[model samples]
Target: MKIDREKLHSPFVEQVERVSGEVFANCYQCGNCTGGCPVSFAMDYGPSQIIRLLQLGQEQLVATANSMWLCVGCLQCYSRCPKGVSAASILEALRQMTLRKGEDHEDVGGLPFPFLKDAPQQAIISGFRKFVS
Candidate 1:
Protein backbone atom coordinates (compact mmCIF):
# COMPACT_ATOMS: atom_id res chain seq x y z
CA MET A 1 0.00 0.00 0.00
CA LYS A 2 1.10 3.52 -0.79
CA ILE A 3 2.02 5.65 2.17
CA ASP A 4 -0.30 8.55 2.88
CA ARG A 5 1.74 11.56 3.96
CA GLU A 6 -1.26 13.01 5.77
CA LYS A 7 -1.80 9.76 7.62
CA LEU A 8 1.66 9.92 9.11
CA HIS A 9 -0.08 11.99 11.78
CA SER A 10 -2.95 9.53 12.20
CA PRO A 11 -4.51 8.60 15.52
CA PHE A 12 -3.86 4.89 14.95
CA VAL A 13 -0.22 5.13 15.98
CA GLU A 14 -1.03 6.91 19.23
CA GLN A 15 -3.69 4.36 20.09
CA VAL A 16 -1.24 1.55 19.56
CA GLU A 17 1.37 3.31 21.64
CA ARG A 18 -1.11 4.03 24.41
CA VAL A 19 -2.08 0.39 24.69
CA SER A 20 1.31 -1.14 24.06
CA GLY A 21 3.25 1.33 26.23
CA GLU A 22 6.06 1.57 23.72
CA VAL A 23 7.37 4.25 21.44
CA PHE A 24 6.50 2.45 18.23
CA ALA A 25 8.17 5.03 16.02
CA ASN A 26 11.51 3.69 17.21
CA CYS A 27 11.05 0.49 15.22
CA TYR A 28 13.49 0.34 12.28
CA GLN A 29 12.25 -2.81 10.50
CA CYS A 30 15.38 -4.82 11.37
CA GLY A 31 13.39 -8.13 11.43
CA ASN A 32 15.00 -9.19 14.69
CA CYS A 33 11.64 -9.74 16.38
CA THR A 34 10.40 -11.97 13.58
CA GLY A 35 13.59 -13.99 13.58
CA GLY A 36 13.19 -14.75 17.27
CA CYS A 37 9.45 -15.29 17.47
CA PRO A 38 8.66 -18.83 18.63
CA VAL A 39 5.29 -18.79 16.92
CA SER A 40 6.25 -16.91 13.78
CA PHE A 41 5.43 -20.03 11.77
CA ALA A 42 1.82 -19.70 12.86
CA MET A 43 1.52 -16.01 12.09
CA ASP A 44 0.16 -14.58 8.85
CA TYR A 45 2.30 -11.53 9.62
CA GLY A 46 5.09 -12.16 12.04
CA PRO A 47 6.12 -9.77 14.81
CA SER A 48 8.42 -7.65 12.68
CA GLN A 49 5.80 -7.34 9.95
CA ILE A 50 3.20 -6.32 12.47
CA ILE A 51 5.58 -3.75 13.89
CA ARG A 52 6.30 -2.52 10.39
CA LEU A 53 2.57 -2.24 9.66
CA LEU A 54 2.10 -0.29 12.85
CA GLN A 55 5.10 1.88 12.07
CA LEU A 56 3.61 2.62 8.68
CA GLY A 57 0.27 3.41 10.30
CA GLN A 58 -1.41 0.64 8.30
CA GLU A 59 -4.43 0.58 10.57
CA GLN A 60 -6.51 -1.79 8.45
CA LEU A 61 -4.00 -4.64 8.54
CA VAL A 62 -2.85 -3.87 12.05
CA ALA A 63 -6.34 -3.99 13.51
CA THR A 64 -7.75 -6.91 11.55
CA ALA A 65 -4.94 -9.45 11.41
CA ASN A 66 -5.21 -12.98 12.78
CA SER A 67 -1.55 -12.59 13.76
CA MET A 68 -2.52 -10.91 17.00
CA TRP A 69 -4.55 -13.97 17.94
CA LEU A 70 -1.65 -16.21 17.02
CA CYS A 71 0.59 -14.58 19.63
CA VAL A 72 1.19 -16.98 22.50
CA GLY A 73 2.67 -14.21 24.72
CA CYS A 74 6.06 -15.92 24.53
CA LEU A 75 7.94 -12.56 24.68
CA GLN A 76 10.63 -13.86 22.34
CA CYS A 77 10.01 -10.85 20.13
CA TYR A 78 10.40 -8.51 23.05
CA SER A 79 13.58 -10.17 24.20
CA ARG A 80 15.22 -10.05 20.80
CA CYS A 81 14.14 -6.49 19.94
CA PRO A 82 17.15 -4.21 19.95
CA LYS A 83 14.83 -1.19 19.88
CA GLY A 84 12.53 -2.41 22.65
CA VAL A 85 9.50 -2.53 20.37
CA SER A 86 7.71 -5.21 22.40
CA ALA A 87 5.94 -6.56 19.33
CA ALA A 88 3.98 -9.10 21.32
CA SER A 89 2.62 -6.35 23.52
CA ILE A 90 1.61 -4.46 20.41
CA LEU A 91 -0.18 -7.62 19.24
CA GLU A 92 -1.95 -7.89 22.58
CA ALA A 93 -2.84 -4.23 22.31
CA LEU A 94 -4.32 -4.92 18.89
CA ARG A 95 -6.35 -7.77 20.32
CA GLN A 96 -7.63 -5.45 23.04
CA MET A 97 -8.48 -2.85 20.44
CA THR A 98 -10.52 -5.46 18.54
CA LEU A 99 -12.30 -6.42 21.73
CA ARG A 100 -13.07 -2.78 22.44
CA LYS A 101 -15.04 -2.85 19.17
CA GLY A 102 -17.20 -5.64 20.64
CA GLU A 103 -15.64 -8.26 18.38
CA ASP A 104 -13.55 -11.28 19.25
CA HIS A 105 -10.28 -12.19 17.57
CA GLU A 106 -10.70 -15.88 18.37
CA ASP A 107 -13.86 -17.83 17.55
CA VAL A 108 -13.65 -21.06 19.45
CA GLY A 109 -17.37 -21.39 20.11
CA GLY A 110 -17.69 -24.47 17.93
CA LEU A 111 -14.98 -26.49 19.63
CA PRO A 112 -16.18 -29.80 21.03
CA PHE A 113 -16.37 -29.98 24.81
CA PRO A 114 -13.93 -32.88 24.92
CA PHE A 115 -11.43 -31.00 22.86
CA LEU A 116 -11.56 -28.05 25.24
CA LYS A 117 -11.53 -30.43 28.16
CA ASP A 118 -8.28 -32.00 27.01
CA ALA A 119 -6.55 -28.62 26.78
CA PRO A 120 -4.35 -27.42 29.61
CA GLN A 121 -6.01 -25.29 32.29
CA GLN A 122 -3.57 -22.44 31.62
CA ALA A 123 -4.56 -22.46 27.97
CA ILE A 124 -8.27 -22.41 28.81
CA ILE A 125 -7.93 -19.69 31.43
CA SER A 126 -5.66 -17.58 29.31
CA GLY A 127 -8.09 -17.92 26.43
CA PHE A 128 -10.82 -16.63 28.72
CA ARG A 129 -8.62 -13.79 29.95
CA LYS A 130 -7.85 -12.80 26.40
CA PHE A 131 -11.18 -13.56 24.67
CA VAL A 132 -14.08 -13.48 27.12
CA SER A 133 -15.94 -10.35 28.07
Candidate 2:
Protein backbone atom coordinates (compact mmCIF):
# COMPACT_ATOMS: atom_id res chain seq x y z
CA MET A 1 0.00 0.00 0.00
CA LYS A 2 1.09 3.53 -0.76
CA ILE A 3 1.72 5.86 2.20
CA ASP A 4 0.96 9.54 1.85
CA ARG A 5 3.74 11.46 3.53
CA GLU A 6 1.74 14.67 3.31
CA LYS A 7 -0.85 13.39 5.75
CA LEU A 8 1.83 13.37 8.44
CA HIS A 9 0.88 16.97 9.23
CA SER A 10 -2.22 15.78 11.06
CA PRO A 11 -2.66 16.43 14.79
CA PHE A 12 -1.94 12.84 15.68
CA VAL A 13 1.34 13.05 13.84
CA GLU A 14 2.16 16.23 15.71
CA GLN A 15 1.43 14.48 18.97
CA VAL A 16 3.92 11.75 18.06
CA GLU A 17 6.50 14.32 17.11
CA ARG A 18 5.98 16.45 20.21
CA VAL A 19 6.86 13.43 22.31
CA SER A 20 9.47 11.69 20.14
CA GLY A 21 11.02 14.64 18.33
CA GLU A 22 13.74 14.23 15.62
CA VAL A 23 14.54 10.75 16.87
CA PHE A 24 11.82 9.61 14.53
CA ALA A 25 13.40 11.62 11.76
CA ASN A 26 16.85 10.12 12.31
CA CYS A 27 15.76 6.51 11.87
CA TYR A 28 17.35 4.97 8.75
CA GLN A 29 15.62 1.57 9.04
CA CYS A 30 18.86 -0.25 9.82
CA GLY A 31 16.85 -2.97 11.62
CA ASN A 32 18.93 -2.53 14.78
CA CYS A 33 15.77 -1.69 16.71
CA THR A 34 14.21 -4.92 15.51
CA GLY A 35 17.36 -6.95 16.13
CA GLY A 36 17.64 -5.70 19.70
CA CYS A 37 13.94 -6.02 20.43
CA PRO A 38 13.17 -8.92 22.71
CA VAL A 39 9.59 -9.25 21.56
CA SER A 40 10.05 -8.53 17.86
CA PHE A 41 9.28 -12.15 17.18
CA ALA A 42 5.75 -11.50 18.47
CA MET A 43 5.38 -8.13 16.74
CA ASP A 44 3.50 -7.90 13.46
CA TYR A 45 5.88 -5.13 12.40
CA GLY A 46 9.23 -4.47 14.00
CA PRO A 47 10.18 -1.21 15.79
CA SER A 48 11.70 0.39 12.70
CA GLN A 49 8.58 -0.41 10.64
CA ILE A 50 6.36 1.16 13.29
CA ILE A 51 8.41 4.36 13.11
CA ARG A 52 8.14 4.33 9.32
CA LEU A 53 4.39 3.82 9.48
CA LEU A 54 4.09 6.68 11.93
CA GLN A 55 6.18 8.93 9.69
CA LEU A 56 3.86 8.07 6.81
CA GLY A 57 0.80 8.91 8.92
CA GLN A 58 -0.52 5.36 8.91
CA GLU A 59 -2.34 6.10 12.17
CA GLN A 60 -5.07 3.52 11.88
CA LEU A 61 -2.68 0.66 11.11
CA VAL A 62 -0.34 1.81 13.88
CA ALA A 63 -3.11 2.09 16.44
CA THR A 64 -4.30 -1.41 15.58
CA ALA A 65 -0.86 -2.99 15.61
CA ASN A 66 -0.35 -5.43 18.48
CA SER A 67 3.39 -4.77 18.52
CA MET A 68 2.93 -1.40 20.19
CA TRP A 69 1.29 -3.01 23.19
CA LEU A 70 3.68 -5.95 23.23
CA CYS A 71 6.83 -3.92 23.81
CA VAL A 72 8.49 -4.96 27.09
CA GLY A 73 10.21 -1.57 27.56
CA CYS A 74 13.53 -3.34 27.96
CA LEU A 75 15.45 -0.40 26.43
CA GLN A 76 17.59 -2.82 24.39
CA CYS A 77 16.65 -1.10 21.16
CA TYR A 78 17.18 2.29 22.74
CA SER A 79 20.67 1.44 24.02
CA ARG A 80 21.87 -0.34 20.88
CA CYS A 81 20.65 2.18 18.31
CA PRO A 82 23.50 3.65 16.28
CA LYS A 83 21.55 6.88 15.88
CA GLY A 84 20.91 7.02 19.63
CA VAL A 85 17.19 6.80 18.92
CA SER A 86 15.10 5.70 21.84
CA ALA A 87 12.84 3.38 19.88
CA ALA A 88 11.68 1.55 22.97
CA SER A 89 10.53 4.73 24.67
CA ILE A 90 9.01 5.91 21.43
CA LEU A 91 6.94 2.73 21.24
CA GLU A 92 5.80 3.43 24.79
CA ALA A 93 4.68 6.95 23.90
CA LEU A 94 2.93 5.57 20.81
CA ARG A 95 1.16 2.98 22.92
CA GLN A 96 -0.02 5.74 25.21
CA MET A 97 -1.30 7.63 22.19
CA THR A 98 -3.14 4.54 20.97
CA LEU A 99 -4.81 4.03 24.34
CA ARG A 100 -5.70 7.71 24.66
CA LYS A 101 -7.60 7.52 21.39
CA GLY A 102 -9.86 4.87 22.97
CA GLU A 103 -8.86 2.39 20.29
CA ASP A 104 -9.86 -1.24 20.79
CA HIS A 105 -7.20 -3.91 20.64
CA GLU A 106 -8.12 -7.29 19.15
CA ASP A 107 -4.82 -8.95 20.02
CA VAL A 108 -5.35 -9.23 23.76
CA GLY A 109 -3.39 -12.44 24.14
CA GLY A 110 -0.34 -10.99 25.91
CA LEU A 111 0.23 -10.25 29.57
CA PRO A 112 -2.78 -9.25 31.68
CA PHE A 113 -1.14 -6.25 33.37
CA PRO A 114 2.03 -5.27 31.60
CA PHE A 115 3.43 -3.00 34.30
CA LEU A 116 1.31 -3.59 37.37
CA LYS A 117 1.55 -7.38 37.18
CA ASP A 118 5.29 -7.13 37.66
CA ALA A 119 4.94 -5.20 40.89
CA PRO A 120 3.73 -6.31 44.30
CA GLN A 121 0.03 -6.02 45.10
CA GLN A 122 0.75 -3.52 47.84
CA ALA A 123 2.53 -1.27 45.40
CA ILE A 124 -0.27 -1.78 42.89
CA ILE A 125 -2.89 -0.92 45.48
CA SER A 126 -0.92 2.15 46.49
CA GLY A 127 -0.81 3.29 42.90
CA PHE A 128 -4.54 2.64 42.50
CA ARG A 129 -5.23 4.72 45.57
CA LYS A 130 -3.00 7.51 44.25
CA PHE A 131 -4.95 7.50 40.99
CA VAL A 132 -8.25 7.58 42.90
CA SER A 133 -7.11 10.52 45.00
Candidate 3:
Protein backbone atom coordinates (compact mmCIF):
# COMPACT_ATOMS: atom_id res chain seq x y z
CA MET A 1 0.00 0.00 0.00
CA LYS A 2 1.34 3.39 -1.03
CA ILE A 3 0.93 5.66 1.97
CA ASP A 4 0.88 9.19 0.70
CA ARG A 5 0.70 12.52 2.52
CA GLU A 6 -3.00 12.84 1.78
CA LYS A 7 -3.71 9.39 3.21
CA LEU A 8 -1.63 10.01 6.31
CA HIS A 9 -3.46 13.24 6.94
CA SER A 10 -6.84 11.98 5.86
CA PRO A 11 -9.96 12.95 7.80
CA PHE A 12 -10.51 9.37 8.90
CA VAL A 13 -7.05 9.20 10.42
CA GLU A 14 -7.56 12.52 12.05
CA GLN A 15 -10.84 11.42 13.58
CA VAL A 16 -9.25 8.22 14.90
CA GLU A 17 -6.36 10.13 16.42
CA ARG A 18 -8.71 12.68 17.95
CA VAL A 19 -10.94 10.00 19.42
CA SER A 20 -8.16 7.65 20.49
CA GLY A 21 -5.76 10.35 21.73
CA GLU A 22 -2.94 8.22 20.39
CA VAL A 23 -0.69 8.87 17.40
CA PHE A 24 -0.78 5.98 14.95
CA ALA A 25 2.54 7.09 13.49
CA ASN A 26 4.20 6.44 16.80
CA CYS A 27 3.52 2.72 16.41
CA TYR A 28 6.46 1.01 14.71
CA GLN A 29 4.94 -2.37 13.93
CA CYS A 30 6.18 -3.92 17.16
CA GLY A 31 4.11 -7.04 17.95
CA ASN A 32 4.01 -6.65 21.71
CA CYS A 33 0.34 -5.72 21.64
CA THR A 34 -0.71 -8.87 19.81
CA GLY A 35 1.67 -11.06 21.79
CA GLY A 36 0.25 -9.92 25.09
CA CYS A 37 -3.37 -9.92 24.03
CA PRO A 38 -5.22 -12.89 25.57
CA VAL A 39 -8.10 -12.82 23.10
CA SER A 40 -6.05 -12.06 19.99
CA PHE A 41 -6.29 -15.71 18.96
CA ALA A 42 -10.01 -15.22 18.31
CA MET A 43 -9.62 -11.96 16.37
CA ASP A 44 -9.58 -11.80 12.59
CA TYR A 45 -6.87 -9.16 12.75
CA GLY A 46 -4.58 -8.69 15.69
CA PRO A 47 -4.27 -5.29 17.38
CA SER A 48 -0.96 -4.55 15.64
CA GLN A 49 -2.44 -5.31 12.23
CA ILE A 50 -5.38 -3.02 12.85
CA ILE A 51 -3.00 -0.14 13.64
CA ARG A 52 -0.93 -1.03 10.60
CA LEU A 53 -4.00 -0.87 8.36
CA LEU A 54 -4.90 2.50 9.82
CA GLN A 55 -1.35 3.71 9.27
CA LEU A 56 -1.54 2.59 5.64
CA GLY A 57 -4.70 4.71 5.23
CA GLN A 58 -6.85 1.63 4.82
CA GLU A 59 -9.68 2.93 6.97
CA GLN A 60 -12.27 1.01 5.00
CA LEU A 61 -10.42 -2.24 5.62
CA VAL A 62 -10.04 -1.39 9.27
CA ALA A 63 -13.72 -0.53 9.46
CA THR A 64 -14.72 -3.86 7.99
CA ALA A 65 -12.54 -5.91 10.34
CA ASN A 66 -14.01 -7.76 13.32
CA SER A 67 -10.85 -7.01 15.34
CA MET A 68 -12.19 -3.86 16.92
CA TRP A 69 -15.37 -5.60 18.06
CA LEU A 70 -13.36 -8.41 19.64
CA CYS A 71 -11.23 -6.10 21.75
CA VAL A 72 -11.93 -6.62 25.45
CA GLY A 73 -10.31 -3.32 26.54
CA CYS A 74 -7.94 -5.18 28.85
CA LEU A 75 -5.14 -2.69 28.06
CA GLN A 76 -2.58 -5.50 27.83
CA CYS A 77 -1.50 -3.92 24.55
CA TYR A 78 -0.89 -0.61 26.23
CA SER A 79 1.12 -2.20 29.02
CA ARG A 80 3.37 -3.90 26.51
CA CYS A 81 3.71 -1.04 24.01
CA PRO A 82 7.12 0.65 23.78
CA LYS A 83 5.62 3.87 22.42
CA GLY A 84 2.65 3.73 24.77
CA VAL A 85 0.18 3.32 21.92
CA SER A 86 -3.03 1.81 23.20
CA ALA A 87 -4.62 -0.51 20.64
CA ALA A 88 -7.56 -0.84 22.96
CA SER A 89 -8.13 2.91 22.70
CA ILE A 90 -7.86 2.75 18.92
CA LEU A 91 -10.34 -0.10 18.85
CA GLU A 92 -12.70 1.92 21.00
CA ALA A 93 -12.42 4.81 18.56
CA LEU A 94 -13.20 2.49 15.66
CA ARG A 95 -16.17 1.11 17.56
CA GLN A 96 -17.35 4.66 18.26
CA MET A 97 -17.02 5.56 14.61
CA THR A 98 -19.02 2.50 13.65
CA LEU A 99 -21.66 3.25 16.24
CA ARG A 100 -21.91 6.84 15.03
CA LYS A 101 -22.83 5.44 11.62
CA GLY A 102 -25.76 3.64 13.31
CA GLU A 103 -24.29 0.20 12.59
CA ASP A 104 -24.24 -2.45 15.25
CA HIS A 105 -21.33 -4.87 15.17
CA GLU A 106 -23.34 -7.81 16.49
CA ASP A 107 -27.00 -8.78 16.47
CA VAL A 108 -28.31 -9.73 19.90
CA GLY A 109 -31.05 -11.84 18.33
CA GLY A 110 -28.57 -13.71 16.18
CA LEU A 111 -26.42 -14.89 19.11
CA PRO A 112 -26.23 -18.66 19.51
CA PHE A 113 -28.49 -20.20 22.15
CA PRO A 114 -25.82 -22.54 23.51
CA PHE A 115 -23.35 -19.76 24.09
CA LEU A 116 -26.01 -17.46 25.53
CA LYS A 117 -27.20 -20.13 27.88
CA ASP A 118 -23.73 -21.14 29.05
CA ALA A 119 -21.93 -17.81 29.09
CA PRO A 120 -21.60 -15.90 32.34
CA GLN A 121 -24.03 -13.06 32.92
CA GLN A 122 -21.20 -10.52 33.22
CA ALA A 123 -19.67 -11.73 29.96
CA ILE A 124 -23.02 -11.49 28.19
CA ILE A 125 -23.56 -7.99 29.57
CA SER A 126 -20.10 -6.96 28.48
CA GLY A 127 -20.71 -8.37 25.02
CA PHE A 128 -23.90 -6.35 24.75
CA ARG A 129 -22.03 -3.25 25.93
CA LYS A 130 -19.28 -3.70 23.36
CA PHE A 131 -21.16 -5.19 20.41
CA VAL A 132 -24.32 -3.11 20.64
CA SER A 133 -24.52 0.53 19.71
Candidate 4:
Protein backbone atom coordinates (compact mmCIF):
# COMPACT_ATOMS: atom_id res chain seq x y z
CA MET A 1 0.00 0.00 0.00
CA LYS A 2 1.19 3.47 -0.87
CA ILE A 3 1.27 6.07 1.85
CA ASP A 4 0.06 9.58 1.11
CA ARG A 5 3.06 11.82 1.70
CA GLU A 6 0.92 14.87 1.02
CA LYS A 7 -1.29 14.02 3.96
CA LEU A 8 1.76 13.44 6.12
CA HIS A 9 3.11 16.82 5.06
CA SER A 10 -0.13 18.51 5.93
CA PRO A 11 -0.63 20.06 9.38
CA PHE A 12 -2.72 17.16 10.59
CA VAL A 13 -1.51 17.32 14.18
CA GLU A 14 -1.94 21.08 14.40
CA GLN A 15 -5.37 20.84 12.81
CA VAL A 16 -6.46 18.18 15.31
CA GLU A 17 -5.07 20.28 18.13
CA ARG A 18 -6.75 23.41 16.83
CA VAL A 19 -10.09 21.73 16.14
CA SER A 20 -10.19 19.73 19.36
CA GLY A 21 -8.56 22.38 21.57
CA GLU A 22 -6.51 19.64 23.21
CA VAL A 23 -2.76 19.15 23.25
CA PHE A 24 -1.63 15.71 22.06
CA ALA A 25 1.75 16.26 23.69
CA ASN A 26 0.18 16.24 27.10
CA CYS A 27 -0.93 12.63 26.81
CA TYR A 28 1.55 10.27 28.53
CA GLN A 29 0.01 6.94 27.42
CA CYS A 30 -1.06 6.18 30.96
CA GLY A 31 -3.94 4.06 29.61
CA ASN A 32 -6.31 5.68 32.05
CA CYS A 33 -8.43 7.00 29.24
CA THR A 34 -8.74 3.61 27.59
CA GLY A 35 -9.28 1.88 30.89
CA GLY A 36 -12.01 4.28 31.85
CA CYS A 37 -13.68 4.23 28.45
CA PRO A 38 -16.89 2.22 28.65
CA VAL A 39 -16.79 1.18 24.99
CA SER A 40 -13.04 0.63 24.47
CA PHE A 41 -13.62 -3.11 23.98
CA ALA A 42 -15.65 -2.33 20.86
CA MET A 43 -13.08 0.03 19.32
CA ASP A 44 -10.45 -0.94 16.78
CA TYR A 45 -7.92 1.15 18.73
CA GLY A 46 -8.03 2.44 22.25
CA PRO A 47 -7.94 6.13 23.14
CA SER A 48 -4.22 6.12 23.98
CA GLN A 49 -3.29 4.56 20.65
CA ILE A 50 -5.38 7.10 18.80
CA ILE A 51 -3.67 9.95 20.59
CA ARG A 52 -0.29 8.41 19.88
CA LEU A 53 -1.17 8.13 16.22
CA LEU A 54 -2.19 11.75 16.19
CA GLN A 55 1.05 12.74 17.90
CA LEU A 56 3.01 10.88 15.25
CA GLY A 57 1.04 12.60 12.44
CA GLN A 58 -0.50 9.30 11.35
CA GLU A 59 -3.78 10.88 10.29
CA GLN A 60 -4.57 8.25 7.69
CA LEU A 61 -4.29 5.46 10.24
CA VAL A 62 -6.37 7.40 12.71
CA ALA A 63 -8.96 8.25 10.06
CA THR A 64 -9.32 4.66 8.89
CA ALA A 65 -9.72 3.28 12.39
CA ASN A 66 -13.26 2.69 13.66
CA SER A 67 -12.18 3.95 17.07
CA MET A 68 -13.16 7.55 16.46
CA TRP A 69 -16.58 6.59 15.10
CA LEU A 70 -17.14 4.25 18.04
CA CYS A 71 -16.47 6.88 20.68
CA VAL A 72 -19.58 7.33 22.82
CA GLY A 73 -18.65 10.88 24.01
CA CYS A 74 -19.10 9.70 27.57
CA LEU A 75 -16.24 11.92 28.89
CA GLN A 76 -14.77 9.00 30.81
CA CYS A 77 -11.50 9.44 28.94
CA TYR A 78 -11.28 13.08 29.83
CA SER A 79 -12.09 12.45 33.46
CA ARG A 80 -9.39 9.83 33.68
CA CYS A 81 -6.68 11.82 31.93
CA PRO A 82 -4.10 13.35 34.24
CA LYS A 83 -3.61 16.18 31.75
CA GLY A 84 -7.33 16.58 31.22
CA VAL A 85 -7.03 15.90 27.49
CA SER A 86 -10.36 15.04 25.93
CA ALA A 87 -10.14 12.12 23.48
CA ALA A 88 -13.87 12.44 22.99
CA SER A 89 -13.38 15.96 21.66
CA ILE A 90 -10.61 14.73 19.37
CA LEU A 91 -12.93 12.02 18.04
CA GLU A 92 -15.60 14.63 17.53
CA ALA A 93 -13.11 16.68 15.54
CA LEU A 94 -12.29 13.66 13.42
CA ARG A 95 -15.98 13.08 12.77
CA GLN A 96 -16.42 16.74 11.90
CA MET A 97 -13.45 16.57 9.52
CA THR A 98 -14.93 13.52 7.79
CA LEU A 99 -18.33 15.19 7.52
CA ARG A 100 -16.76 18.34 6.11
CA LYS A 101 -15.10 16.14 3.48
CA GLY A 102 -18.64 15.09 2.37
CA GLU A 103 -18.44 11.58 3.75
CA ASP A 104 -21.35 10.18 5.72
CA HIS A 105 -20.72 7.41 8.23
CA GLU A 106 -24.23 6.01 7.96
CA ASP A 107 -26.91 5.92 5.27
CA VAL A 108 -29.96 7.56 6.71
CA GLY A 109 -32.24 6.19 4.03
CA GLY A 110 -31.00 2.65 4.62
CA LEU A 111 -32.10 2.55 8.24
CA PRO A 112 -34.73 -0.14 8.73
CA PHE A 113 -38.27 1.12 9.12
CA PRO A 114 -38.92 -1.23 12.02
CA PHE A 115 -35.82 -0.07 13.89
CA LEU A 116 -36.69 3.54 13.22
CA LYS A 117 -40.18 2.94 14.52
CA ASP A 118 -38.97 1.10 17.61
CA ALA A 119 -36.01 3.39 18.47
CA PRO A 120 -36.55 6.29 20.83
CA GLN A 121 -36.80 9.77 19.37
CA GLN A 122 -33.67 10.92 21.22
CA ALA A 123 -31.66 7.98 19.87
CA ILE A 124 -32.87 8.60 16.34
CA ILE A 125 -32.03 12.29 16.52
CA SER A 126 -28.66 11.62 18.06
CA GLY A 127 -27.90 9.02 15.37
CA PHE A 128 -28.79 11.50 12.67
CA ARG A 129 -26.47 14.14 14.13
CA LYS A 130 -23.62 11.69 14.67
CA PHE A 131 -23.90 9.43 11.61
CA VAL A 132 -25.38 11.66 8.92
CA SER A 133 -23.32 14.08 6.91
- Which number leads on lDDT? 3
User: lDDT per prediction?
Assistant: 0.82, 0.73, 0.90, 0.87
Off by over 4 Å in 2: 102-133
- State, as a TM-score between 0 and 1, how close model 2 is to the true structure: 0.72
- Extract clashing residue pairs from model 4: none
Of the candidates numbered 1 and 4, which has the greater TM-score value? 4
Residue pairs in candidate 2 whose N, alpha carbon or C atoms collide under 3 angstroms? none
Residue lDDT tens for model 3, 86-129: 99999999999888887987889999999999999998997788
Scored by lDDT, model 2 comes in at: 0.73
Instruction: Name the top TM-score candidate.
Output: 4
Error of 2 at 113 (Å): 15
Order of the predicted models by lDDT, top scorer first: 3, 4, 1, 2
Please give the lDDT score for candidate 3: 0.90
In candidate 1, which residue ranges exceed 4 Å CA deviation?
A: none
Q: Report the Cα lDDT for residue 72, model 2.
A: 74
Q: How many residue pairs clash in each candidate?
A: 0, 0, 0, 0
Which tens-of-lDDT digit does each residue in 75-121 have in candidate 2?
A: 89888889988877777677666656655343234426766568788
